[model samples]
Target: MNIVVPVWGDAYLDTFLEYSLPAQLAAGNVPALEGSGHCYTIYTTAEGRRRCEEHVAVRQLTRFVAVTFKSLEVVATYNAGNKYRTKSDCYAIELEAASRSGAAVAMLNADILLADGFIREALRLLRLGKRVIEVTGGRGLQDPIKTALDSEFREYNRIISISPSELSRLWLANLHPQLAMHYVDGPEGGSFHPSHLYWLAGEEGVIIRAFHLYPIVVKPNASPVKFSGTIDDDLVALLAAAPDERLIAQNSSDLFCCELSPPEHFVGDVAWRGNRKSIIDFYLGYRTENIENLEKEIIISSKPPVGELWDRTRRDSSDFIDTLISDLKSELLRRCAAREADDLMAKAAAEIEDDGDFIKAIGQMLENGHPIPLALEERSLRIHLKTYPDRADLLQRLCAVLGAQGKVVPLELEERALKAIVELHPDRRDLLERLRLVQVGLGKTAPPAALVSPSGEEASQTEVDFQQDAEEFGRAVNYRDMEPEFAPILELARRFTMTSVERMYALYKAVQYIEATQVPGAIVECGVWRGGSIMVALAALRALGNTERDIYLFDTFEGLPRPDDDKDIDVLGNRAINGWLPHARGNERSNWAYASIDDVRSNIGLIDYPSDRIHLIQGMVENTLPAGAPETIALCRLDTDWYASTQHEMVHLYPRLSVGGVLIIDDYGHFQGARQAVDEYLAKTGTPLLLNRIDYSGRIGVKVQKSSVGWLQKLGWR
Candidate 1:
């Protein structure tokens, strides 16, 4: 019997000799391949061939004929374009060498160490005319002495061996070929063999008889070797075509041929290492019944070190913590119960403090503009408050973080933090105003009556008083340096018009939708007021290095066109409203009524992005969007405040909006005309798009499955 082991590199040579070779020699079937005067070939890369040569000489394996080669380029010419050319090239050469010896050949991977008596039983079955014998590697079957190269083989046959009779008794055990072990009888000149295919394209071998050593007769859990290419599909194809009568033998003992991790995709129970349950119970109750264990095996037979296992466990646990926290937060958010979320968050925060990596993961998520779950945010706030009771700055930052997600600090915390800040500063009227606003938001009290003046001139100071009275205190949560994602855009917006938080959120969602769907189109921002929000879109694109998508900015670059009676019917109806046309038409400082093309261009230039990607079309949307808009739109932001312009964008851009793209109506909650345009368009087209509100103002709708009304129109259905 000749063992034909194919070794690519010298990395696992030590383990192979200690655990595999000795067992085969102990079986007493025949001489070792080295002593038998049979050619032993090692297929390897140029460097690997050199290393193997040096290793054999240093180890003084004097009898072994170490034949090594760099390239089987000749093999490529034999079977060009074969998917398994890499494997076939080497295997063909090995089998060719074996054919010359006329001795039965045992094919093996150098990474595996054979169990005792493997060679004797294999030879016994081979002499009985078993053409192929496969050995399956299973969990915890390693040769303990094989862990070290110099350890003498303590040949305990009962523990290490699987006899033929014992294997035959446990024939019901399932085995898969991925365990990577097999033996073949030496081919005579007239017989079929896989090596024949090297010269002929269609020739396939036939295995007249096959046997499986099912208790796993080898330990494959040696030090890991990483292979570079994939040829398993080709190998399977070759095997399937070979004719064979397969006989599988399962060893009833605790022995396994190789140490293999149980298959992850296998829903059936296989005994996993480190499991507390007895192996017999696992096999009889679970493995036979095909039940899945939640704690599936994680170890691979590469025999990774103890330190590596610890590191892997730590990393996996950290990921599980992140997922668990996220799930808990989502449930709390849906319930809108702050107390429930806080309880879980507080526990998690304390537990994660032991893991610096987990803490950094949470921080990284927040820095990436991930909204902090309300529970987590509240728990963090409480921790910080306890650490620094007088830290108003920290409290304010926490408040801003929560406020971005439309959450407020608990009423008591809000009162305490505001009072401390106001007492310390004594002149921050803004803080006083915020405190009063928080009170009103919490529904704690009716607003105090307006203060009257002594001069009987109806001198109620409430209208002039920004601290005590205002419709809305904060138009947008102050991100400042906290959210780098939107900070620069907000700073740019402040230079022209007051960009609402709601509007910024809508633009944020625009970038998200484009990226998520990978929608292939440019962004079209209609009614670019002072280029603030448009700059937001451009900044996001530039940050992502997305120069492929173009920006189409359509606006009058001036105040809204005077309401024509036919078109401005909706606009005229809101004329008497205080925040309607009058406020929108103002041309004074920072008013969004007038947006000059030059001003928008100048603002956009301040951002460090390629100017060529932005195409600013200065005209009313009604005049420009009819022809100037991009044919495909990922996002269409409508800031046009009047009915006419709104109607124009809805007609021009909506139909062309990419499927799964977003359309953000910036003034949906603020302007009746914007809402009217959106509602009317959906109604006419019978498009079933739900309007989801982003904040107090902006509303967005993702284009769903496209309406077939246009196709129906072509057929004259309407």
Candidate 2:
């Protein structure tokens, strides 16, 4: 006997190879049949063939049986789009292949598990002069039970013996109690379809009567009719059997087979409609001239058990519909309650003026799964922090709620809250750990030693005052308003850059700083990936009517230069520095980081910025900064991520940065190397500069007065 299987898709193939095939092999039907001259053929796609071969090698399936694989050529019309067409094509091909073998063939679906001794029982009937054998033991196993059975089989390396009672228990658990009761008492019992026969294992072995019989095993040359996807399987069985040959329907009590329910073995009204079309097509195709005879045959078949099953089905369906209606009503009531609760929360939030009460209202909304506008929650939290700076408990609760909702809280507020919590509770190692994470998320390497007391002492009053002052500065710098003219440019720039709107607003602020201070110099950007940031600066410059200032855009214009592994490690301990290509798998140009110089020029052209004033210097910053960079810079933006690049840019450009010029460090908080380079350069210069936090990963600092001496003393007249 040759066992022919047709399977497709990764999911079905995985289940078939992992569970179905293993069950058959364990049942002594696969390798055990080699002595009886049994072979196996699997028909699948090219990719599926690769998977099957891999499985065969890993499981050594060929060592047991002479297994052969055939790749079914995928036809665009038949095997590509429609699943039904694919199934039909596979069956047609497998049947054709089986016919050529000149041996008894058992055609089976890939997504089914055969019972122990099923093949032997089929062969016994064949030896007893049965030309075509229909094995009636098709049971429907729900997904969860199928998963459990697969797990058990894999763990034990054999099919675990499940008694008929246990099988029935598993089947009933997946069904509603009312539905299960009806099914158990119905004419079909546990079978997949109403017209199908069902049998259970008992002391008498297995006893089954024919019910919409399917030809499980066929003798050589007996299958004259070709099978198709458009024709039902049972109809194919009926047509395949020769008029002179004997046909028998039987099942061994020791043998059983089950298909996974819901999907693999579909049930209910939709499945019936689909199957009915194919059955009707088969009958029409069987004898086109005998329409009357076909109708008579259908009427004859619809007598007795099917008629009884139909009446039972109607009654069961009525009960199921009533239960469904009750469930729907309960669902509607639950939704109404949820909506009322949401309205109450919104009303409370709108009425509440106190910052503390407002925070509580927002938190409650989040806890109850009510949607709260991100801007509203953010503004409320910021206001609460201003009024009650030491309320780490409320802050933590709000932050946790925001995190759970996947809402991104401003990193500044998160850092401030975590610092207060850590300082107030020095013994809280968990809080300290959380503080480190927040710091890393801000693009900083680690929390400074001074932030955490070594002796576990509570934060002093001065420390609290400093935190309050920092919070005040953050509020002062928050760019809440978008200038009307810059809005369109910002929108256009978004297409070229991944920088947040907040960061872009900060850039606009930098332009405002230069305008107010009358700082005279060009705008210099060290790492211009796609020229988005430079475009923002150009827009701001244009808005301020400072079109005369030359903007020097410096970059490799390929991607990021390779980082120094020892000095450029991230907080997560990843040495690969390109954020665009975190794993550093392929060439730098492969990802978003690699924008061409021509593309940047084209993007600038889109905004109609002064072409000559914009200097698109293309090369590594280390090499280009020495020759291509501007001599004097008023607004310098350093986005270079590596330690060496950042350090070099600071060494060459810091001196050229005029007094009161704004220096924006884009990767200062996110990249440890970038932060370290900025800190080291600032420390060497001994400049009294205040690096204000802009966003999570950006910092803006104005190069202020270098002298520590008083104005009068510096005059030398005193």
Candidate 3:
């Protein structure tokens, strides 16, 4: 049968296209021979019409029309003077469109998903002459793909149909004297009520009473009740006199339009009745009316012809007042409970004596399926990891919890777990390989890479130190007892700059490059915060007794220069760059990462290494590098955080970089600008260098020696 879906705002557009429509088509019901000839109408506002058009064209949606509200045939008969106000008003037009199609119209909400052959089953039931068919309630569409994968849906899904007589009953229930808000009877003594729910529920006797539950606006499928039928006898009696015992639902979808009983709270005197109006009753009175030319649109007016209307209005007003007072009291109680929960959380955080109690409480919350912030849970895990590093069971449990919840486990924790796993089964190469791949997929360096010795053997002796070092290195790296001779330099470096596994990995690669390559160039670092990296490099070279190459350190010495707004473009090729400018001065002092030259010198001084070979360029690299850059660079590190600085470094250093020398990029993953700059330079210059990631944030590449520069010149490079 032909369907007319009323579209207004984008409150449910994504869900409608992704899940609802797909579910409908899966039923294999072609409307080619039926009403509207397979082409459905989507009555919407001007903006909505444009969006629909764009969506249809982009997604190539079939059998759907992005129709304007004024274009609907219903407007032709009506006054067409802004009569459509609420969703019900628009739905009325949709119903009229469906009626004219000469087939049973499917009144489905945008959020509802139909099962395969649902329409066929519905048609079969309609042929059996059932006035009303109760459709099966669907499980919440947490993930549409996951829902479709559910093999139980065919047995669980159902179809419902409403006869014309039942439709009339539903319409009247929605437009009664106590339900409708604004009424305007047709000039010819005839009338119609705009009911938003008549399209879903069938028959006059089928009362659609709604009750309240905690509402999370984003999750539309989380209603307390669905497919409710057969009201309790006591509830019927109670509702007859006091209908405002439960709050009105937000929409028809809030509760399923199927055969089930309503919640007991609205039925019993002992139930939690903080005096609230039935949601269905509230919806009916909120918008659109059957009679026009009424007195100030008070929903009910006092007059000889409408005296009963006045009585209904007075009762509704009293119910509303009582609901407000009760709601106020409930709010006070909720606040008090919230304060208690907060006090408990504070106690858990502060008192080490109650650590087990806190852990048990959090575990219970998770087990009960309560919504808790992921960060809070993570903080607890961190505390436990710190207290018991050797607990493999705890680490595994934490990892499983994070994975199930789709949270990213911290690199440090993952490494700690991997180390534990390796120690448990040191000969499990297959497991170690899988774990390494998993770590790489999560954008973290494998722990084995750091634990392996220079002779390519697993450093089993240092495995214990590796576990402790992993956590310490994340915050700050030190050579204390690990390298007693260089502890002074590491002590100074660790205090001044942030440390990470990635930096150490890159430094190791740099040392290898120096030892293996026979390049006649100076060692340079484009961006040195407190000169930690350079200090490490110098100490390594000094220990190796190879201090022939001059180490060039470049920075602002005052901090990062301000960004150039106009010339520093922000985005390129879906990769966001901080700022890229061919020529612009740093003028804005925002939150740019900064460091001073004095701190750099102090860090270098603590190393107590030879200073004759060290070169300090105390200015922005963009200004200083072009004139003062080394003619040939053996090992170059780019730690610049922005696109422009990174671009400048690559352009000046790449050509000057000696063959087989290593080029380390510190912010390859963290800063989009630095990545883009490197990628653009590599692409433009036709370089075949392969970049290998050291960790989540750093990557290193070596300039391969070539027999000819023909490949470079092919891309117009000299």
Candidate with maximal lDDT: 2
Local distance difference test, per candidate? 0.48, 0.59, 0.48
After superposition, the stretches of candidate 1 with alpha carbons farther than 4 Å from their true spots are 1-435, 438-484, 564-592, 707-718
In candidate 2, what are the lDDT values of residues 1-718, reduced to their tens digit?
7787777788778777766776667545664564746778787788888888877432555767788776655422222233444454555555555567656777777776665566766666677766665544345554776766756434454444343334434443443222221121333323222233122222212222232344566664634445422223333443445544534332223444555445343232101222332223222222222222111111111112234444454444445434533544465567569658866777778788887778788777755655454345556756866777778755875665464334666787788778877777788655676677667778886533333332325544234555544544444444445667767877767656656677888998788888778786778898887788888888877777766566788886666766776777765455654443331323323222556676688878765665645666665665455545555678999997889889989998888887778999998877889999989987776555678988778999887655632442365422
- Which lDDT tens digits does candidate 1 get at residues 1-718? 4444544434445444444444434333223232444334444456655665565332333344344343544443121222223443455444444445445445555554454456556656655655444433332213322332223334443112323223222221322222211112222222221110111001111111111122111111122212211222122222221224222333323222443222331212122222222222222211111111111222212122245444554355345434533543464455345435534544555467544444564465344323234445555656667778878756765655554333544776777779777887787666787788678767875765554333434446333544332334232334432456676566655444445655685686579668767875678887776677877777777777765466778776654555433333332244413333332432211122444566678888777765545667655564344445655777888877666678878887888787878888877776566678778887787666767977656788887653554565566543
Candidate 3 per-residue lDDT, tens place, 142-203, comes to 34332332432322332122322332223233333312211221132222222211111112
Clash pairs for candidate 1: 216-256, 216-257, 217-257, 218-257, 218-258, 219-257, 219-258
Q: Is candidate 1 or candidate 3 better by TM-score?
A: 1
Model 1 weakest 10-residue run by lDDT: 194-203
Model 2 compared with the native: what TM-score?
Answer: 0.33
What candidate 2 gets wrong by more than 4 Å, as runs, is 1-480, 577-592, 708-718
- The C-alpha RMSD of each candidate to the native structure, in angstroms, is 28.7, 26.4, 27.9
Superposition error at 159 for model 3 (Å): 99
Regions of candidate 3 where Cα sits further than 4 Å from its true position: 1-492, 564-592, 708-718
